[model samples]
Target: MNKKWRWTIGISSVVIVLVVLTIIKIGTTQGAKPDWYSAWASAASSLIALIALVAAAVAANATIQTNKTQTRQLAKLEETQQSDRASKFAVWRALHPTRDSQIYRTFFHNAGPLPMYDVIIHYFVNGHEYTSKEETLPPTSTPELVKKSDNNLEWFIKKLAIEEYGLYQPKTKEEVAAIADLKKRAEAENVRIELVRAINEGKNRYVKDIRIETGVSFSDGENTWYRAPNGRLERTS
Candidate 1:
């Protein structure tokens, strides 16, 4: 089964055959009976020994070659495992964007109407993820204080857009639901609205998310703005 035993067995068989033939040769050629038959037998024994030695050498070489192939295969398997782990990590980071560490800044309103804009914060959301798109903020105050009595809700929404109009980013049908959800959350919390919406308002493709501007809209058609982690103001894309 093992190389050592296989070599021993092959070598012993060859030596035993040669020894037997040599002993017979010496006996037959002792005296008055010089048998020529013993010489041919001795030659045959030598040929058998040479064949067995070649077989042992071939078996050893095959074993070494097999080990080499297995080692190479094992190394490749480890490399593939490492690569798979790294790819999964990249995908997760892309999705969440906000993992660990302080990587972003934002602003929002706390509560109440015109005379108070309580808290204007600049803090990090999630450092792990980057924006898939931009989000807009809620209006600063509700229509409860407005003078319009007809269709109070719509009036209030329009007023909020005009007065604190800084928070609105035009919405596609799909984004409308998310905006509504944000409004509901803002009412329930009774605090400043926090919105990070994606936009394509400019030539900058990298500006995917914009924080609310609190109370400012651009001149013609641009109103969205990006707040970097250090509070640098940027025109939205």
Candidate 2:
């Protein structure tokens, strides 16, 4: 029960017992009982009541403390569960022939117990870094490719030509020959791709990076990227 009720009941009980003892003491004193006997009995009764009050207070305090501890433990367990569920991975893979330009797709699936938040995929193609332009993927969900046409394909084509043929430009008479050589070299070289992502899981955050490599040697599919399990061409006609 509450402290006020406990105190009231305890005081009433002590007072009742003391009154009965006093009555008995008076009766005995009239029949030769020592005068100090009544004094000793009253002191003993007061002491007993004080002890009972202290014990009740202690028990109530202990119950309150136990409840607080249990509450903290339960909160901790809930946080742990959320963090576990939120664990996820975002993989970047190149879409082969989905569009005219080679596009990379960032796909995510929840690998842990909690939901993923702000799962942004940052990628690098041929040494230039680029962030995903689309919204972050949620838990267990795979999002569409972060469309990037910022980097001009024509500029990249020229760079590839310069790197392979060691010529930035060709004369008008040799223009056809240069064009043929660039196309031939571009088909033979592998495009270097790298992917990384950052994700928020509750109060914590994690960043991860994966190496992107061609599936085979320098060939037709060598320029494409793919994530494990399901990174293939998805025709969205």
Candidate 3:
């Protein structure tokens, strides 16, 4: 038999043996044996039974306590993982300034005009740099920029929420002039330029996935938030 069943049978045997010994002693004391031996035998059987019962109770309680400890430990581990994920989300939100890129991203998911946003240069290809520029989809405006790019794989975005993603604005003549003046004063960093277009809702529905497409440099897996050249949430790619 199994170890547990063996233990149970052994304990039962011990109890039965004690009871039989007690009965025999009682009978002998009334006839052949002395009264003192009978009394001692009865006391011994009672003590053994009490000890066995106490041991069994302790064993059962110990098993229950161990199970409870394991359950609590697992719960604590899950809570810690959830807390870590939440902290990461907060960090990303602080770093990525979506509002500075465009006003629509700052307020609501506008389905009209695209908001201008910023992004760091992922890298330069030839003379152009790849960046995740901020783009917006303003409400009431036709999101033709994205729709017409259906043939263009590079311009495809999964979903475009109004005011959700940011937009990128081009460098103005004044800004370029400022850059020239700054070069005469001191050589500043060269900024990359990119185009951002707004997307329409339900226009090109597909597999039901919308990704943040600032340009070639966009990384949805990035933990960091992007910023624009104008010190806004949006940046040119």
Candidate 4:
């Protein structure tokens, strides 16, 4: 069926035709066979044997090549399966209802066929970095919401406001009245409330203007992996 087989069959047919013609010539001879007949028969027999050997070698080589190709394909398939199993963890995001909806939450999910361990997430909010507590995630489990109280954007902004402008939220009616009077005095003097001014000038902008970057690192008991904010997953170990 293949090229090598086709060539082998064609050569064998040609040799048979040559033998048939030699016999016919001998039969039609007017006397004893010609002197070259024995030598010609011997040479033709050797040629047939050589062709058979070459055909056998070609068939063996083709079988070896086919087996090598199949081996490579099976190895690649196994590598792909292992990669799928190890790269099943992901980081998730959602808004949280707190501090007037000025904060968000980070979550982790394990969608793989195995459990992930020592999971940690790194967050960068407007260039300020924060890290989450380590945890373990089970395969095909529900997404785990991060609950660190100090890890929210609202807390970061409040901390900055207090450090830079001595700003604090009023907790009582008297404090509220005091802040209101202070605002009125600033307005009368055509001056700005430092905290309010900073917020309005976009120095401490809202969530829409905030840039948040996130990445996650986890282990599959043998190797570690990191998933970047842009969804690029790579092995770390």
The global Cα lDDT (0 to 1) of model 4 is: 0.67
Of models 1 and 4, which has the larger lDDT?
Answer: 4
Displacement of residue 106 (Cα, Å) in model 4 is 1.6
Q: Write the per-residue lDDT of candidate 1 for residues 1-237, one digit (tens) a residue.
A: 466866786777768776776777676767754566566566666867676776777777768878888999998887554333221110010121246743222223313212221212221222221222112222343222111211232223343333333444443344454555777644533322222232222212222342322122111122233334443444343
Q: Mind giving the per-residue lDDT tens digits that candidate 4 earns over 1-237?
A: 478776877687677767756765774573765767767666767776776677677778779888999999999897666568666678767775676654457776777877788877777776777777567767766777666623554566555545545554334344344555776655533433443455544435445576777888887887778888989888787
lDDT per residue for candidate 2 within 99-185, as digits (tens), equals: 476543433454543433333344443454444433333345444333332233323334443554444232333333455677654
TM-score of 1: 0.27
Each candidate structure's TM-score, on Cα atoms with residue i matched to residue i, is 0.27, 0.36, 0.27, 0.55
Which parts of model 3 are misplaced by more than 4 Å? 1-32, 39-43, 53-60, 63-173, 177-237
List the candidates ranked by TM-score, beginning with the highest: 4, 2, 3, 1
Q: Rate the local accuracy (lDDT) of all candidates.
A: 0.39, 0.44, 0.39, 0.67
Predict model 3's lDDT versus the native: 0.39
- In candidate 3, what are the lDDT values of residues 1-237, reduced to their tens digit? 345864785687678676767676677658566776767677767867776786676667667777888999998887554333222211011122344552111111223122322222332222333343334222333222332222222233322222234443334445556665766423222332222222333323321443222222122232234333232332122
TM-score of 4: 0.55
Best by lDDT: 4
Winner of 2 and 3 under lDDT: 2
**Off by more than 4 A, model 2:** 1-32, 88-109, 112-118, 122-237
User: Distance from true position, residue 59, model 3, in Å?
Assistant: 4.2
Candidates 3 and 4: which is better by lDDT? 4
